[model samples]
Target: MTALNWKLVVDTRDAQTLADFWAAALEYEVEDATPLIDHLLKAGDLPEAAVAEHNGHRVFRGYAAVRHPEDPYDPFTGIGKGRRLLFQDVPEPKTVKNRLHIDIHAEPDGLETLVSRLESLGATRVNEVDKGPAGHWWVMRDPEGNEFCVA
Candidate 1:
């Protein structure tokens, strides 16, 4: 088997809110793991201590995921079909730049269009990189300040 099952989970101050924002930003949805986890809890299959809330939001307190629409979901896991990003709750904020940031490629001239669309949804462009061999890109951050590049 290939070692290809890769998922990155970011620790954030707000898991649910981060999940919601990323759901919109990436055109993905929050994985509704609550029902399954809840059922396990009520059935004594899971420990009550496995769950907690952050910022008054009932979250998995460990991890949540968002995936692009038009994607398939794992019937067994109920996780997303396409590209996914997972968020988890942590006690602290992001202290430094991401070591592995995502780069989005799009029409450079129409960047304003994307900027407006993302901005209207709470994303913001932090910097504009110059055109070169790799082409130009915009450094944008999620609502939680997670940085990504848009080209």
Candidate 2:
């Protein structure tokens, strides 16, 4: 059997804003799909309504993505080949706890600082958990209410 590749897809009301927040939180780069957009626009293959300006570049209007800086990507589409998160615009608001979530491991002795930084970047602290000798972590919600953990 061969290994599979995948990226995490998130639903958000504002894809660009969520993507920006996640990019900063993860120290990742927002995928730049301008080249592909430009090519498609020139070829009359893409509609203007499907494009939007983000960070001063053209991107797919209801979609945004971030990828680890070291990951390989296609220059034409700026789609990452590894470790990516794609956000898509949705009509409904998040109404319940996440079924699956991300766990961020902080550098040794850096938990508080990491948490603070994430808060400044728009994550809300939900609660802190302490399991003596087992583990400790904080439950956090991204701006869109998606739950994640920091440890």
Candidate 3:
């Protein structure tokens, strides 16, 4: 049997904004991939219309990436973390609840700070979920409606 690597790639209306939110929330870096864009442009492989600057990084007119600061990265492609959240541009808004979502744990005395911080960055609390034993978690959404938990 063989095993393969995995990551979550999300479709979003605003990729760069979502990327920034996640980068701050996870203490991750917004990977600067402008070199790839430049290379592709020089090679005539991608159109100028397909590239743009977003959040100070050269992003795909449709995509951007954020990953944990301490997360392990693939030396070859620069992909990071055992887990990563990628934002790609999409035409439509999110229309359904996420079937799967990311879980976040806050350091001691950090939950309130984190929540306020994320909210300021445009994440809003959807509800407080008190599942058995877990007590409570703030079900929150990114500026674009992708849901995640903050505990």
> What tens-digit string does per-residue lDDT give for candidate 1 at 1-151?
7656566788787777777877776667677666677677779987777776644434465677887677788754567756788887787879999998877656648767776777887888899888688577789998889898877
Q: Where is model 2 poorest over a 10-residue stretch in terms of lDDT?
A: 89-98
lDDT (tens digit, per residue) of candidate 3 on 7-99: 789888888888888888888887677777787888999999998887565677877787767778765345675667788887887899999
Against the true structure, whose TM-score is highest? Answer: 2
Name the 10 consecutive residues with the lowest summed lDDT in model 3: 74-83
Badly placed stretches (over 4 Å) of model 2 are none
- 24, model 1: CA deviation in Å? 1.0
**Against the correct fold, how does model 2 do in TM-score?**
0.98
Clash total of candidate 1: 1
lDDT string for model 2 (32-57, tens) is 99999999999999999999898899
Assess each prediction's global lDDT (C-alpha) against the native.
0.75, 0.96, 0.81
From the highest TM-score down, the ranking of the candidates is: 2, 3, 1
Candidate 3 lands at a TM-score of 0.85
